[model samples]
Target: MTSSAIIQNIPCTLVTGFLGAGKTTIINQLLATKPADVRWALLINEFGRIGIDGALLKGRQNDVEKPNTIAIREVSGGCICCTSQLPLQIALTRLLSEHRPQRLIIEPTGLAHPHELVKQLSAPHWQTSLSMQSVITVLSGLQWQQEKYRSHEGFQAHVQAADVVIINRYEQLDATCQQDLLTWIGTLNAQASIIWAAPNDASSELTVAQLSMQLNQPSASISKQRATQSSQSRISLTLPNHLLTNMPNAGNSAAMTMDDEPPYRYHDEQQGMLLAGWRLPSHWMFAADELQQWLLQLPNWQRIKGVVHTSDGWQQLNFTPDSLTITTTSAQIDSRIEVILLANTDNSHINSKVSKNERQPLIDWDVYDHELMALLAK
Candidate 1:
């Protein structure tokens, strides 16, 4: 493909899932097994203001063969399917125009509504240039059993939009639970191709061959929108670069330098969810064990993920109700963490998703900030 030639019919895949569903891990696996001759571009939309997934991906790429062939961009602070659609358009167009990649993979923030996004992506503008393939949604079978997830509209839509569904970590459950979960999924979308996979042991994910099998199925993404639209007033999104990938981060946020900048924090609330993210200066190091304990015990939240500089070295932390995994990492940059919690949370110290006057109390963010800083290495 010549640089001057127009790019069209790029094979595009969207990986949709709920928080902590291991979307990044699966993407990393796909990257490892991607065709050596094909140039692939990845766009990750993050729910938190401080972007960490892009950094995590770039960090792990050191182990990918011919990793230079991959192009990565991120849009953070809002879901790309809605509030940040403009940013998505800008980033997508630029990536295709500049990279002319043979394949495109988009990871929409887990909280986003897939039905609306599919409509927008299949709009007249992108219909001809990009060929939409399978929409893959990942979820643990345990999640399906929880009433909180089963009743959630975003979670349900993700399953409905998927051409292929991956029910990972289901082996951890007993036979009865697994059967009930599978039955529930069938009722939601009887047409989806379901694959059962073993739990990922932190370092690995669904094989490329398995992913390709799913992608081969043509997508029948939900075309009708169901969820209530967020306030159309656009939310600001930040696209940051913590990688030395030769490409610059888009001018999307205030944190200009990852190494030297002081800790930057941003908070956002949408769709009855509250998200917060932080970026600490690179020099700040924490006691790994202590930090892990503190993060795991965070008062009340749905999920927390971070890549940080620890006395034990750079570590990546992923925590959910069912599992907690921490592993060493090769990529280094400003240490950062992101947390997600339900909007009507009972945590008195945290803010709920409500208007200025209706908010419970001026959340004493200082308290949490102090708690985190206290774990810093002496």
Candidate 2:
């Protein structure tokens, strides 16, 4: 709890995790459970233009008067660490200058690098204004087993860069799997404090008794010994295969201007939209056992998800870009998996690929399930 000598403001918590690892869920819970005496300001960064997360938090603040206890600022267009860091600084300046909330909670996009983001926030200028209280990373259980995601750079970085690692979906893992995960985590980041957290838990089991080992001290001391600039990487936007296909020039899914809202409202006309997706027909059916087997066997794919159609109905499958998650949801009946990818790639490449229809997958679409399975196996 070191306070800055120049500024008397409290430090902020930078909550980061890969996509859908439950960063928002934990933040929402923390906000709900925090003492009423403390006020909070939420800053959410998203990859796309649509600020859905901000809308969600605002919806929950219905009872608060306009300009009250909680305030949310949405930074869109690119990952927070990518193009939005300066904007984040500006926002923090305004918040500190005006509102001066007790706590500043920043939820970076799932793909953001915590070390890099923290470096920016802890700059000499911002030091007086804000300090980092913690850097928490969340992980999904099944991701390690998925070959496609096993060695994923982002997922590995997420685990490696954490001060604390929170394992989500703990209830879904078997005892042996859980133990194996713990062993694997120990080998990866021995210094990180690992805690198993479920969505329903009111209090994370990270009590003083559970944290007796004091795993993160060495990492902290080591970090203090090094210069901050040593940790940052050269930032750039490299679109994955899925995003390349949605470029305005790519195919049927061209970038449409915001005014042209017929097909679907895209964030930018210059950068239509890129969705990591897979389409399956309704005729295909997998029983519970079959589904579990398929999920366990699927290759690693981060932000890997698609709509799945089965004899029973339509459903959605979601996973981390590192292949950590293999979850099925019946909430959407279309049975196709479509994850929204960001429009942060170079505009030139996007336009070229979209206009030329050159981004089509090499695999045939007739028997997509088998073709997909074969592709993933590679």
Candidate 3:
């Protein structure tokens, strides 16, 4: 291909990880440092129907001096590689054609099937126009401690397929655990560039020049190594109803669709995991002290994240086994929260009366729901 042809084709990168693994944090950091001249687009697929990630990323374009430098799209409520392939294709093709970004970054829902997803991204139809880049999977050093992360196929596939694994919160690991992590990486034989970065460091940013290389370039196999769905299946796409539209369910239930309503809620379960999320109206502010108290008391959930319009301001909250933080955000949108818990809980709830051996839903949804709703400002 000619140099001009190569330049015209947008380079794409897939950032995949497990729940609460810091994928969104690292992507935000990359956008914060993006070059002033490069045009970019970001497609975010989240497990929840609420589109919380998209809302968090909405203010990112303002971080750049150039307007419209970063265009955002969402295909929430399902995994892009399997059930949501058509939406992923539609959103992606539109991102490339309309925005004409120089580079594209996709943050597939953490629960996505990475290997199959990559195979879809690297398929034959995209060979000429889209240059794939390194698959970067952000991982918390603590993930290894959990048997769930070690045994889960989706989590394993993410790390195994990555060309770069940014082990965030690496500082927390001791000499032995650090070595163990390295050994596990070696066992995978993924040949990925391991970036040991502290979660707070600015050094983990992914650069445009780094992602724009030709897939055939010696080091750029990061591109040659990825995959995708068939493009021949009518990919006409417009992103009108982006939230809670295609979210998945654990069993046979259909996904719910929320009108332009406040306080929308959704829950789903699959692969022994449960995802619950809420989207509250902007006016539904909460007291910071009460919020913190309530959140701190609910520790059984595997992960929790949201940006709420609190009395203090718009605050972003993230909680995982590895870290917890509540910081301010400028993203002006509705308040939202996403909580994920392992479904195999043995009476994980604080108020649970289930016998020690009897399994129950990770949390008593009715109870927590009432508590959180009570915290909201009337």
Candidate 4:
């Protein structure tokens, strides 16, 4: 019998994107607007040893009613598409066998390469149980247009592999920048459906099979410019996931495990090294202001995330790529500061790394609160 004849299973939507491309934001928006008749589960990947992303997503479970409204599984240490394909299969099998949700949404890490991922899903084992319905790539228009991202081999792979590309943060770009992006998109995949997004019109969905596939050669100057920009801006930071989730002061909590039966191990054949992660409770939250203050003190901090118990509720703060945002529900007043830090050449704890000008404490909390309330009032 053919592989498709073996399982004859359901279809799954794979949501892939580059770093800082708003994948989580789009996923959340999709779940929020889901018709009451459809059931779905969300699988998330983390590059760190800790699974804070999975924990934060769990909070969404409380907001929906469908038994399969949302189920979160974590793929850690590496990305699901490139470095952890087996886990992806296991997660899908378990979700299907257990929850049997009507749909499965796979959210790969920012660094994940979607083309490699989709190719894996075409394997006989997976083809039987799941159909690769669509590849949804969420992109930040401003960031996508940056000289650094548009030229990367990985970025090219990401854009070329998409069935639908959701252009987010569209309002952040100027008219010229937006037009350039649209033109660039046409060159990348003319058949792919492109959707412009803003907060007011954040909810958008596309059926993958209905889209087009197109690819064009990128200019050499564009590639060189991207390389220069990326080298100057890229930063890396590594931490034991345990520090983010298991700390005594941790707040938001949840339990997470690898769906893989044996729990795959990480090893580097060339370097003869093995990498492993410690499991931390799913609960932890952070205070927005305190977290920002802490980052200012870390000379080498690149990307950081941690669970913190805020006065209002639970939250997780992710700090990386020059920005820190708290992922929390607006319903509760949860406020606390926690994060994971990733560093590059800037990863120094020396006095020279610290600017002599000194700095004032961050008091953006009260200011931000007032601004938020004022906007809400308006």
Instruction: State which candidate has the highest TM-score.
Output: 1
What are the Cα lDDT values of the candidates? 0.73, 0.52, 0.68, 0.52
Model 3 per-residue lDDT tens digits across residues 1-378: 332343455777788898888887677666765677878789998877667767876776566656777899998776778785578767877777667788778899888888777777766556666667677888777787667787778778778878777787677678998888888877884577777754465553343333233222322334445421311111111112232233222121122223544555666775567777777667556788898777766655678788898889999888877778888988466778877777665543544565777565435566666677667554
Ranked by TM-score from best down, the candidates are 1, 3, 4, 2
Candidate 3, residue 77: lDDT? 73
Q: Tell me the spans in candidate 3 whose CA falls farther than 4 Å from its real position.
A: 1-8, 62-65, 198-200, 204-260, 348-364
What digit string (tens of lDDT, one per residue) describes model 1 on residues 128-170? 6777888988887777768998998888988888888877767
> What total of clashing residue pairs does each candidate reach?
0, 22, 13, 31
Q: State residue 282's C-alpha deviation in candidate 1, in Å.
A: 0.7
- The candidate that wins on lDDT is 1
lDDT of 4 by residue, 267-321 (tens): 2110111122222222323344654564456543334555554444455566555
- Cα deviation of 233, candidate 2, in Å: 26
Candidate 2 lDDT by residue in tens digits, 236-338: 1122355344333323222321232212222221122243333222332434335535543433222444444443344344454433443333433223333
**Winner by lDDT between candidate 4 and candidate 3:** 3
